[model samples]
Target chain A: MKRKVFVASSIAAALAGCAKITNGLNEWQPAQPILNSAETLNQAIIGTRGTARLYRPGDVTLDYPVNSLDTPHQPEYLSLIESDFTTYRLPVGGLVDHPQTFTLRQLRALATLDQITRHDCVEGWSVVGAWRGLSLGSFLKLVRPKPEARYVVFYSYDHDQSGQQFYGSLNMAQAVHPQTMLALDLNGKPIDAAHGAPVRLRVPTQLGYKSTKWIRNIALVSNFKDIFGGQGGYWEDAGYAWYAGI
Target chain B: MDATAGSSAPLPRARSSEAGVVVRRHSLVTRTTHWVVFIAMIVLTMSGLQIFNAAPYLDASDKSDPARRVLSLDGRTTPAGSVGVTTILGHELTTTHLLGYTDDGQGGETARGFPGWITFPGYQDLAGGRRWHFFFGWVLVLAGAVYLIWGIGRGELSLLILRPSDLPKLWPMQAYYLRLRKEPPDHGKYNPLQKAGYTLVLFVLTPFVIVTGLVLAPGFDAVAQPIVWLLGGRQFARTWHFVAMLAFIGFFFGHVFLVVATGFVNNMRSMILGTYRLGKHEGTGP
Candidate 1:
């Protein structure tokens, strides 16, 4: 695991030189290991570089809300969030050495960070909200993920446009990034239902979609080959790009 | 240099070359930027359309009527029967069904424009499409910056600048384009209409799209927020970007048709090979 982390940081160190080769037009050709490295290196770079794996951020103040809710309210989610998320329990399990669970209060007790950042939607809009939450990296350290765990998959209670369960994933480096957080507050207040209340993954570097909202579980897995649509995330299954750091 | 393409001589040269009357039309910088920007335009447009396909709704921009939406071709549909088929706004000339609708192979119907064939990845992958869009969007911006800087430094930007004197020349060129006038104006490298078209696209619309695109980007917000807020909002910037894209498409078709009608070889050769043959005298046909 340490070696993987070291190789990732090393590759990301030179990612700017290989941006074209990794996510460039050639990514469509699945057989090219060079291209695969480009992607891995891209994630390493974006997620690990200054904000590697993470895309670029505004050098200035990050307080902006582009838009809200691409989908309408769901009754299931409505009922689930009705208790004000005070009863919310975030289950962290699957391929890990120490599986654990945390209630809302317990999560609040962990080390927290407040960041004002932008949320870029794939549909070409952006919003900035202040997020305060416990660091995902701190939680991962506690969970002690097994060496076999490569992908940290996030499952949400929210339903997608296709009526299927919404889920997103991060490669190990992304999941364990120090900045990644389980955001409980938005704009100085608890995140409301429409904004992925209870808890949402506030990934300052990734697109809004990859930051799974209404968090329920985090599953560590070796690969996503057989999961959902077998591409990675719910949107990934519906033909979206799995690695959408851009 | 503007001295080459934007020369204020207002007179066509009498000299000629064996290949053509090679009066340096476009500069090396011009040619390179043009070709690069054209490719970037294709990639940006295709990927943009793909991103649009994911959500495909346009809010009518009224607080009380937030739900009133004009569906994009991906969400829109044409009322059957030929006369009033609600075409994808500006794509009326293109009769392909792919431009406005899709049969999802199931009973449920969907609306889409430009078809998957012309889109990047040619499938429903907004994520991949976005990467391509952002990537090429940067290329387009860089090339545009190069063109602008080169044109400004060389005074070539004046080539596309319109003046009161250029207006009268338009009437004669329009007549010629309509075949009413037999003799073409001696407007040198570019005629009045060409100048106006190029001017509007290069100095006006392209910048509008670029600035608005920056407004839509989350990363550029600190610097772009003022402009974005002034332009109504992020959604409005996106709306204008879409409008600018349509304007480009319109410009492209008209530009291509004119190139084909006015000695395709001479026009293409001038752009690519930097040598345009003298009309009729050089054995070239329009």
Candidate 2:
């Protein structure tokens, strides 16, 4: 009886001491920043110059899987869908010389680019998609981001079950890449609710989650430390690497 | 009889003593690399399986299609309860309590491609699995490189690599193992089967697995599109990666079996202490 009690006490003490460690198995911070190093090495060796090359038009794939389609805030999505996104205004501000609010029509009127590219998901699946939109580089040129801006934070209408808004960010180099765009169309069709209607960021270089959908705001910031969860992106906060080049 | 069994054949290469003949079997490099690889491979394989559970499907085309799934783990409902179903090449098999849905580590069943016990962290966390996989992946590569460099420089690979002369001795070794022959054949440090198995793993399977692994990385694929194309795309690479993992697992079972069967103490001593004893009651036969 005494030994059993001692074992129980030890177990309790160990659990108490390792509260953070025991909460989640894969939640601990890495000793070495492998993801960051991999991203740097990938960039250096590939010589992509921050650009993930486009695919040929013939390679455009129609079948695509929609993941994390529903949002916790259904009313917000319903209102956007009800108004056909006409009332939607994408506010681009923070560390920019000229902050601008762009409507769907206004975004469409900007210099357009169409490219087919592969979307590699972190879940080990992939799809080739043809996207049409204005290059984010062209839009960033208009916004005139301040030299202090180091990252571009994208806030979207969608939220997880916990009501946390879906958000992601990109380094300045990737933000201004020619291939990165605020995509409006997919496969010659207007973006649907199932696929982040109105506008979504298309970052072919990075994993799928980085290409955030239903974008509501774009903020240029020096750091994402003050953002929600303070991990650059919602998924990044949930243990995914911020730089998912692999 | 056992003492005089090999008198007519070639004498074993060892220093004979009263009890037995002791031979220096492994070098420090070989033993160190072997253990390092063993640990790294365990971590790599478990974490890799965890990563695979994220998608749990294999395909050949660049774009994934539900219909073209070559392998998948999913759930099924029956009157008894929910069960796991594993589908391979359009053939379905009920693999309940093993895959698709299994113990959630809290005395409950949860849906997952692979079970919790076999996976690292005992939970489904792709990011965590990825971190562990990549970390050990580098360790494995570095260790393999060291072994390769040392093996080549010291001409140690000749023992592991099967030469044209080793081919003819394979059947005899097989016969000895199967007890079709009364006596084991005269051999050098490694038998013919050992040379073949080691050669296949060290040269063919490991390199193929590594190449396919690189292809699965989008960043690498972006740079080496031509090479990826030759491999038939990332999805194809993923399929082959799983196949290679299965092959490695099979090889591991066979390796352990041989180690245990052919005088477990002596084999372990050779690997760990760099010495092996050859005498009566050592292995299957004289």
Candidate 3:
């Protein structure tokens, strides 16, 4: 009886350990912050001021894969798409000194930059395409964000099977990076529905997921602690790296 | 029949004639790092396969093209049913129930790059895979760093480093393994072939895998761009990473075979307990 009990307890303890490990697989740990910081520092060490033209134009993949293509049938998104996104207004609010809601036309009127860059997906595929839009740095200058605003959160209309909406955010350094853009056009044409039509966050220096699509709201926030899932982005909430520079 | 002159350093003469004497074979640090690296590699390799399932293709250029792809896994539907296909170097193979399609750890079969049994978590979870991969990746790097520093500081690296003079003894060692020679020539501490294998894995394959992996990281791209260019490009680096993984797997199998063939119990004891019972003969190994 003693030996049997000991064996039973050992099996139970092993099962408990396995459960803990599985649960901790996606658990938010303190080391993530340190890792993110280290990654950011590595980028800085390489002097990637985001000015370097990385990919050649000839290498651009004309037929870029459209990810997160499942459009939410939300009423707001449906109405916006019906209007051809013409009446769409991007509200930039929260920790910014000057709150503004710019129409697509107004966004187009801002200082725009067109560059052919590589889009590296986290899944190990790379696609090169030309993106035309206002440089996020120039757009930030116009918005005049408060010094306390450390992150720019872009809200999307897409969601997962669990009905959780898709969203992503970038730190102030990444938000103001020269290659970061609020893209209005892809492949020298107006953005199509499959590719985040009205506006998309195009961050060439990071993974493709960091570049959110169908951006409806832009909020400057001090931190992402109170945000949905509190992990900075949909994929990040699902346990991907928030920095995503890799 | 006798020890090769061009082999490594001289071995200590056995003091016993019957029951072999026990001797210290490994340091505490060596044993610790060896086990740590062994565990970390298993986790990294499985999780890496899980991550690879996300794209299931290896390209040779900056962008993925059908023509330039080195390896690809795809699914197809025929009148018979859906079948998983794996293509490599222009040759196609139906890898149904395995490579391109397999169980999802649930009863249901799914289309994936590698089989579920071989993947970490044994399901489709790229996000989870990346988390496991990065965490263990750091563990491997730290363990590797400790081992490297300790090896260099203690001059243990010389035991694995092959010299020009050791080349002649490699064939004799191979012949011993093939049973073409009756007695294994003494090669002190490590045989010439063992030295060559360890040197290739430590100094060549491991570093190549690491550099290629670093090249895949976008944050490190700026610094690693020149290295990437020298190796062809980003996609080539990615392909080479997978190739290096295969080579590591091959080395692992060969290493295990040798451990078992030469002296399983003694070798295991030496690695685990830091001590080995030497054979009656002075030149006999652990």
Candidate 4:
């Protein structure tokens, strides 16, 4: 009986300690706020909670607009993408031996492959689509990264109202995975504007966001800690996990 | 053989209260089975979380274009003839496109079956989900069967199954727990709360998760109607599944809390080694 009392008291003390640690971590506010403040945290939390309020409990609606060559052209639905060999320039900088620029043509000149894969969303939706592009490994080889380089960060053109760019990072292992590709085509034909074209990324093992859509620049960094939001990606800085691998 | 057996009998009986603790408690087989169940639960939880992640959503906006361009099917680059070949930062390259399509007000053709491009299965992908869940379930059921049989043979079930005397004791236990007054009761083997938890998990939660999962199986539309009706139609089943999942999550966390609270070392040793060192006056308290 005395032993049981001791055990119970010890357990109570442990639980109290755990509760204090959790509460403190949650309440601690960083000196420099990057994304949403505590006030907006509630709103963001509400938006995420809305996921449970799905119209169809298990069903998901793919709201992205789809297009085909056979469909009649609607002027309003006309492509928003503007393309010219000269207009498309990829800026590669940060911790590199040579800072160079590559147009759409240069990227296409390399070997390419077409792959069919699924995009699994965290909200519990999945869709399969064919993607065609050059291997990301091939591009990484061309860069000939410095010995100090530890992470490769992708900067995108798409952004929220804050002018913050959509970004993602890859460790050396995943960056060099043979399956990772910089895709330019969908299905059997070229990618439509609705889909990321010119060049988008395809990382089969990760979620949809890990595969960034629009490509505008690339940066090699020693560490991800100094980056904006300090969490690696735009959404990650807000609250998302950096490693979204399945 | 008879002489050896006779000699060992007196030896065990002589030390029954000292060296042979199993004489007054669980048999070796029952203790082993209980430990197996404990280990299985831990493995299932860890590996299952790795398969489908829900926590810690990533923010992709701050990343560079190459890092951000992880995957895309839409053509957004400029036409080949318009842009020049230029490297941005020695290594990174960007290409614009002309073939990008805009999503006007009209929704496009609904693709049938699964899309051919993406490989990750979603939560709604009943086919894939069922495959993994059922495979794991068979293992769980087999383990549970062995446990049930051993428990019955060893009279371990008596400790687990609630008795009439447990009814009134629950209120006082609850009060004790809420007020943090004292150790609730001296449980012979399993406490009232432990019995209730194990019962619900075995007879209620597991069955619900499995049956509802089967009902949502893909390409099995033949039984869909009957199953739906049994669950009070599709909507009700879906709602039930969601609610049941929440309850299971709650139970899982509560189970962990109990393990942590009830002497982690002793609990772990009991479940792993099948040897529980009952303290002096262990079952004497109220």
Candidate with the greatest TM-score versus the true structure: 3
- Error (Å) of candidate 4 at residue B245 is 1.3
Best candidate, lDDT: 2
User: On residues B1-286, what C-alpha lDDT tens digit does candidate 4 reach at each position?
Assistant: 2211221242121221232243223344555655665544433332232222221111122111223222222322355433312222243233322111221111221111111111112112222322233334455656778877766764556667767777676675666658765656545455666677777787788788656543332212122445645775333443455456567779879977877876686766655544455542244111
Backbone clash pairs in model 4 (N, Cα, C under 3 Å; residues 3+ apart or in different chains), count: 91
Error of 1 at B178 (Å): 4.1
- Chain B alone, TM-score, model 4: 0.55
Residue-wise C-alpha lDDT for candidate 2, range A182-245, written one tens digit per residue: 9999989987878888899888877888899989899999999999889899888987777776
- i-RMSD per candidate, Å: 11.0, 5.4, 4.6, 20.2
Tens-digit per-residue lDDT, A52-95, candidate 3: 23676777788988877486678888898899888899999989
TM-score of each: 0.60, 0.84, 0.86, 0.42
Error of 4 at B281 (Å): 22
Least accurate 10 contiguous residues by lDDT in model 3 chain B:
B1-10
Error of 1 at A7 (Å): 58
Can you write out model 3's per-residue Cα lDDT over B11-90, one digit (the tens) per residue? 34344342366665666788899999898888788778888888999988766666799898887778998799999988
Worst 10 residues of 3 chain A by lDDT: A44-53
Clashes of each: 20, 0, 0, 91
Name the lDDT value of residue B201 in candidate 4. 84
Tens digits of per-residue lDDT for model 2, B59-133 = 877667776789988877779999999999999999887888774434356777876656765666788777777
Candidate 1's docking class is incorrect
User: Which candidate model has the greater TM-score, 3 or 4?
Assistant: 3
